[model samples]
Target: MSKMRPSKKELLEGMTPSTVHANEIANVASGELGLEQNDSLTEEEKMRLVCSRFLDIKEDDLMDGDYFFTELDSGKYDEA
Candidate 1:
């Protein structure tokens, strides 16, 4: 007999950052943005939210190629 597979909700609930760095980044991003930890959101999404918050830009404004580190390194969001 075949075993039953987990549902999407179950999978999402069990999901976690694949690496230590990813987890750290997600935690920092969420804390900085005053957001609660959301398991449904990917690491990229969390970082995008951080970038959007700091840059005063919409999350939709960031493209796939855009990264929070790149934006932070660019210093565009630094207060004058």
Candidate 2:
């Protein structure tokens, strides 16, 4: 018996706002930003660190819910 992976739609539908934000933060922290994983930090803390480093914003602003993340145009989609 083999395990099956979830479909794209299923995966997308299953993600909550926090899950999506965590995934984005992890990717940028590890990949583009080349940040190391800190075991001492919680997911929310890691998110704040990543956003602060990437966007050059203060952690206080993030904690106060003053900033939000958005997907940018990566040229993967055509303008209709």
Candidate 3:
């Protein structure tokens, strides 16, 4: 599919805060900027590392809550 481009009108539309947040999520997912890592990784490996780093960052901010995706599970997502 072609990329979704938000127009000036779309950006300046009189949307509620929730709608704006949802739009932001859509923009991020379409050109997402969540996580990244160094070189020497294949495309698949980079994806795994990116997801792992995102989880780690979330855990850092939310230390009071239990992070259920850690390596304690020891499954495919073992690095988290």
Top of the candidates by TM-score: 1
Tens digits of lDDT, candidate 1, 1-80:
33476796864674556623555545665455554335457889989977787876677887665577688779978999
Clashing pairs in 2: none
Q: Write the per-residue lDDT of candidate 3 for residues 1-80, one digit (tens) a residue.
A: 23465897887689777556765556665223333223445779879977887764654465433455554454856555
Candidate 2 lDDT by residue in tens digits, 1-80: 33375796886886788668765645653443343335557789989978788776666665333222222234334466
Worst 10 residues of 2 by lDDT: 63-72
Give the Cα-based TM-score of candidate 2 against the true structure: 0.24
Candidate 2, residue 58: the lDDT equals 63
Better of 2 and 3 by TM-score: 2
At residue 66, give the lDDT of candidate 3.
43
TM-score of 3: 0.22
RMSD value for candidate 3? 12.9
Candidate 1 has its poorest 10 consecutive residues by lDDT at 30-39
Q: Which candidate achieves the best lDDT against the true structure? A: 1
RMSD of each: 14.1, 17.5, 12.9
